[model samples]
Target: MEYKVIAFDVMGSDNGLIPAVDAAIKLLGEQKDLKIIFVGDGAALKKELSSRKHNPDQVEIYNTTEVIEMTDGIMDIRRKKDSSMVRALELVKDEKAHGVTTGGATAPFIAGCHFILKKIDGIERPGFMPVIPTVVKGKITLLLDVGANLECDPEDLVNFAVMATAYSKAVNGVEDPKVALLNIGEEKSKGMELHQKAYKLLEDHEEINFFGNIESRYLASGIVDIVVTDGYTGNIALKAAEGMGKSLLTEIKTALTKNIFRKLAALRLRKAFKEVAAKFDYKNHAGAILLGTKSIAFKSHGSSDKVAFYATLKMTYNAIKNDVVNKLKKALAE
Candidate 1:
């Protein structure tokens, strides 16, 4: 059939192969033109597929003798070439698949991609950038280096800005995505030397609409299209936002169900509340694209299940359709 091949690691998450298999089957039903390589234990995968009785033509399994676990480090990729994560990524490396997604350990996943796919030449290291959905309807912001480079040069930050800008334009349909450096304060001299240097580089960049510095407070306010930072700070920001999102969402539910009058009010705004909840549900698009890699590698949350895995499948499809890697190469070249 026509090749719209995608690869996924069936052994990536805590939920075993069930969620990945379910999502794969769902995706196959939704898109007939798609083909998938579910890389993992073949016997296990075949059992699951047999249970569902899906056609082998659409969803094929690549048997793996090894598996990279959460405790594995970067060197695990070297030792475990036959792992589901490595094997799935290999399909992308070999051009057998357009992209791959795995909810595996972050270190090995990045290591596997780096060791196999390599960086896109000009890129020093691949950065994990996630599109965060904001409270504003149809509004999303890109956050880069969420857990990639712990330390980065000013030019690296500039490259991230360039890459994310192109991604926003292609995927999110933003004409000119406003880019900002994440800083302790909005002032030019507020943070460390890295921020100062990166600020100058971004400010001087003609390609992106550099919006100076963006404090973390404005991240959820949807004031800018992209937020760039070193992984250390970015990771902190990501975790904090996640914790706050969960807390706030919990608080909302608790408050709404407090009494009869509030429950009645909640009943009235049920549709609206559900819509808002959906927007806040990052699990609905559960992953970040590893930009700067030779091939697209999607890193989903380790706990991701059926709905989350399905969301990453959609993300992989979008990245492939947009030719994200090539577009990023072109943008960085310019």
Candidate 2:
């Protein structure tokens, strides 16, 4: 069987390289046809792997002298060209790897991808697309332009829908995915000029199943498969949802242990509470893809733990296995 090689930039993560290294070893154990190039401090990575029992043939380390910090500026990609993040991306650019994953700063990582991987043919601009869980269990929605481009035009939003729809079909197994424009109202005339214009274009586009405008409050209602918006707005919405989920879970925990009666009640409802908590856990959906790029450039959470990092690695592997980049090109061309 043929193997797919993935370049993992295992630096600049908030928790250090342990999470990424542990996840890589676990992934290699299950995926026999996969190889991982851990791009970071060679000695440190080798030391971490020494205690872990993994197939030596499936792992390699590419030592880098530098790392891109979270505080680094956007142009640091050029200044720190020898950094782990840049080296990992280069593996894909040089056709040595099928994809790359990083837990680096958002700006430099996205910028590096744009300059290094370049855009897919016919893609005007790349967007950040993340899979989000909906209110319905086991269902997900794709949100794009989440801090990729600060602003976008109507045509760019349409391109995001096209890219997202292609992703939904290929990876999510959703055929003819229904897409919506995130707006203040459900009417066609809602939102800014960009949203209004995008609504019309999405409606006219034959490739996508346009579901019209959807209010932000309804995002978790599981009414749409994909939601398109500008980066500025999408970023805020994503953060707000993440913060709200955490706040609600905290509040529930506090309420459960307030008194003797509540504590007793909590014991009886522990399983139910866990199920609800799992549905809203951000760790379950921690990775976001820099779509419209020529290769899969996955950005895991900067503060990811082993569980979150593993989820991202699985996502990157699935993207490569499903040939998502080529499918995206076909979607745009058609």
Candidate 3:
């Protein structure tokens, strides 16, 4: 029998295993086929489980005392092989689990993935792809190479687009996802030499629905389904977008309060505000899937709460159910 076990790195998060353990209990309650190997300090983990009323059959603990810190360098993946992050990667590599997730350090997590699970054939480097919400209701966009390869060549950008197309189809359920290069402008002549070369390649490629260039302003405009760029720019863009979302919420709250008339009007629009909040709630789509790896690997926000971790768990299950890795391999092969 194939057990759908997830190797969950339970350390290094903002609050450590409290949220992680809660998420595991909730997920195990939801997905009966699923089990999580919580890789961390065995004594503490067992104590947490003892407190919770979880079934012994569906939950297991993998003892590990070492944790990769955020300040740790990529070489630590080799030196700190006994760390929780590396142990989680080893579980996926050894087929002890179907997928792996970590709230640990991003650099070491990516490095551990490369050093252990290994990249799929033909992938120069694995890219971090996250599905973010757009202004358009019921629609979302996939941002690729979000924070992995900060410096990418034209070929790497092309590979990101191809891999993103596959990911969009599998996870977002878009049959013909419109792929676009994130650029300063929509014009072919705009941007630096990197996008200039990548633009020509995306246009010439017949496999994906190349939608020309997309300006950063339209990233949330729902104009395109997939935005491909180098990790540096993508990472900055993602953080900026997240910041803007917070600013918008803050501004809306300020506007809704302060006066009696406005307060009365806000009551009428409470449901509307809730609808919008749920629409752009980052927690609903938490975790970045590391593309180009041979096995399923995901990186969760270091400070994600229990709700966010639960969403990450669900996202992992969705990717696994869709056979995202093998499907991505087939797409890249074609």
Candidate 4:
């Protein structure tokens, strides 16, 4: 087994570095073939590790005193050379690690990725690909450009489709992942000029299994394995889906706990409810991978706790182990 190393940006998280550190320590124990590098303040990291029981040989620390604040703009990526996020990314760039994961500010981390990691050859722009759960049990959909590029052309959509298809095959174990364009209606000509052009491009593309256009309503239905759209539209759809999932779950809880009889029923259905909750929980999903980059990079939620961090770390390790970047490159080259 080839050993894998994943770097974690241990600062800028809403809950601070402790969660990241704890998650890394736990992961190291489970994956004997994996090692971890924590990029952050040396003193704090050492202090935290002192209390945790982990294999010292599998852990390393690259100390950086600076941290990119949530308010920091994209330009700060270049300026903050010693920041935890940049250093963790640098680990991948320097070939010290196979992948990088962070619960840090999004914009600067993305900009840093564009500048430092660069894009895979032939990819015009990188897309934020998150593994979103579908209504179908144990099925997931890959939604791209959640906020990476505000606007994209037909070619970009095709590239996103190609990349997503490759990811679905390599990571999700799909034989031939079905791809769709998110539009106003299922009709090919229903959307704007961009969607129309994208539909034609995707339909003509031989690399992916194009499934035509999909409306936002059916995005979570697991009808398609991947959904491609411009960042502006995709971001709105993603947020709306998240909001609706949370609201529906909240309403269900309210309805089930309002009366004594309903409370008993809720108790009886506790396992089923947990299964549903786990499917929709952001913490379980963890990170949005920056697809089309030269190497694997993930942007975890800033508010993620230890569980979320662990999920992201495990994903990063698996992507590296599976050689996701090379598979994607091969797919694009074909």
Candidate 5:
């Protein structure tokens, strides 16, 4: 289960661009069947490659004259015809690579995915499926439509649940994954009309193990493995969780360093506390699969460092090896 080749957008990072590329190439080179292709200014990448003493022969560069600036809006997709994001996706559309990974602008990546890789059969919209860390046995949950398709119909949400459930079972090793819709309350009457409709749809579907409805308060409880929602709400919830985690860490650090006595106590509990903190580190799980795409495409955080970038590449490799695209397609066709 080797990925033939993995393509990356090499012009997105503000810093660590060379190190990220070097790490990806080094990691993939270790795999016998894996080859790496970078899409960006060929001369610049080659210069960086030479500095790292990395073999340019093991890597292929798809030269693109235009580079999409990180500050550009999603409309930049149309503005930058020769952008690396566009070129990377073009490789996927042309079957030059098994998948593409990018730590680039989210809007441009979404636009490129829609314009180039396109949607899968029976899927009118593509969604972002990101793995959320759970408290249950250190397992991960799949949250679908996380800032990809902002407005979604009932059928779209239903499809998201199905695709997310399949992805959780396949990648996270969950059997008969419990699916829940994000709602304001557990009661059937809670939430908006669309949520109620989605609830009924899940309840009526026998294929997935619908776990009624889950409130935001119970998000990290790990009661369910998949939480389905439209991109707007899901994106806010994901960002909120991330912010909360960072804030909590800041508060803890401040409290622990207040005085000599507290600092000593912090040192005593530092190892255990760090272990707990690592559970919520989003960088550990950096890639989000652009579900419903014809080919695998991963969207990573734009500000990701070398570690996060490497994690994304690893995720891309696993998704290709696991045949995630075909699995999602077959599940959707059913």
Candidate 6:
């Protein structure tokens, strides 16, 4: 499939922003008919591109007058009409590009996407889906509403499940992927009122493989392919997992360096540790996908390095080739 171009908001000053952009552009150059649109300060972007020896001809810049501050509140989105993020979103809405990629502030990205790209038919809101690495080899689990729509209604949760299920099948190549709702307990009546309603709705849906509620303990078991929850809880769970991973690594390092004998043992197992670290490395995973949007919009971590940015762009290309939007349309219709 011929993807016209991918739009990016190159307005952040995060340490990884420029390097990530350079890496993504380099990867996209290898593919045919794929162009990139850098929506930000034209002269600055040009200078950065030149410094990296990247050909300017392959990229189109939509210069903006205003820059959205990283600390700017979500409401600032309405005031920053000339911001680069807003301009990139407009390009997607205009069909000038097939998708958008950004490592900017999450609030502005979500606000701008909703304002410009809009939502798909029958979708009340656009939910975020972040692919988390699983214990299964070469496979990842999809976590919905990572940080968007904090207080979703029961119907909204059901919509998230539908969108997430379609996304997993279309992108992960999972046929009849198991879908689970994140709850405090595993029983059917364990969660709050919203969970009860969502559970019933999911259970009633004949098209989806709605598994029973899953407790947080089994989150990374690799048994369930898609886990649905409101953004508030999902974001907390994601951050908690990251913190735990870091703490575990720190403890292991401390234990290994306790003495020379143990240090020697650590050296022998260095390769094994590296292999294990690779599984938990967030850089290998791409950015979060904004589901239910008419056009694709991915929001990468602000601290994302070159590898993560490249993965995000590559995933965007794959999503376009897979016709994810069409698949979502079909599933929503059913």
lDDT of each: 0.88, 0.91, 0.88, 0.91, 0.83, 0.82
Clashes of each: 0, 0, 0, 0, 0, 0
TM-score of each: 0.95, 0.97, 0.96, 0.97, 0.93, 0.93
Q: Taking the tens digit of each residue's C-alpha lDDT, what string does model 3 give over 1-334?
A: 3568899998888877899999989988888888889999999999999999877888889998688887888998899878899999999989898899888889888888898999998999788988778888789888988889899999888888888888888887998999999999989999999999999998998887999888888888898999999999999999898889989999989988989999999999999998888778877767999999999999889887888888888788778878889988999999
lDDT of 6: 0.82
Q: What clash pairs does model 4 have?
A: none
Off by over 4 Å in 5: 1-3, 29-32, 53-58
Q: What would the per-residue lDDT of candidate 4 be over residues 1-334, giving only the tens digit for each residue?
A: 4569998898998999999888888899999999888899999999999899998888898999899989899999989999998998889999999999999998999898999999999988899988889888778999998998999999999999999998988988999999999999999898889999999999998888999999999888999999999988989999899889999999999999999999997899999999889889878787889999999999888898988998899889889988999999999999
Better of 1 and 6 by lDDT: 1
Q: Which lDDT value does model 4 have at 37?
A: 89
lDDT accuracy of residue 288 in candidate 3: 91
Q: What TM-score does candidate 2 get on C-alpha atoms? A: 0.97
Clashing pairs for predicted structure model 5, backbone only: none
lDDT of 6 by residue, 87-170 (tens): 888888888888888878888888887777888888887888888787888777888888788888888888888888888888
lDDT by residue (84-178, candidate 5, tens digit) is 88888888889889999988888888888888888888898788988788777676778888889898988888898888877777777788999
Off by over 4 Å in 3: none
| Model 4 misplaced stretches (Cα beyond 4 Å) | none
RMSD in order of candidates: 1.6, 1.1, 1.5, 1.2, 2.0, 2.0
Error of 2 at 59 (Å): 0.9
Better of 1 and 5 by lDDT: 1
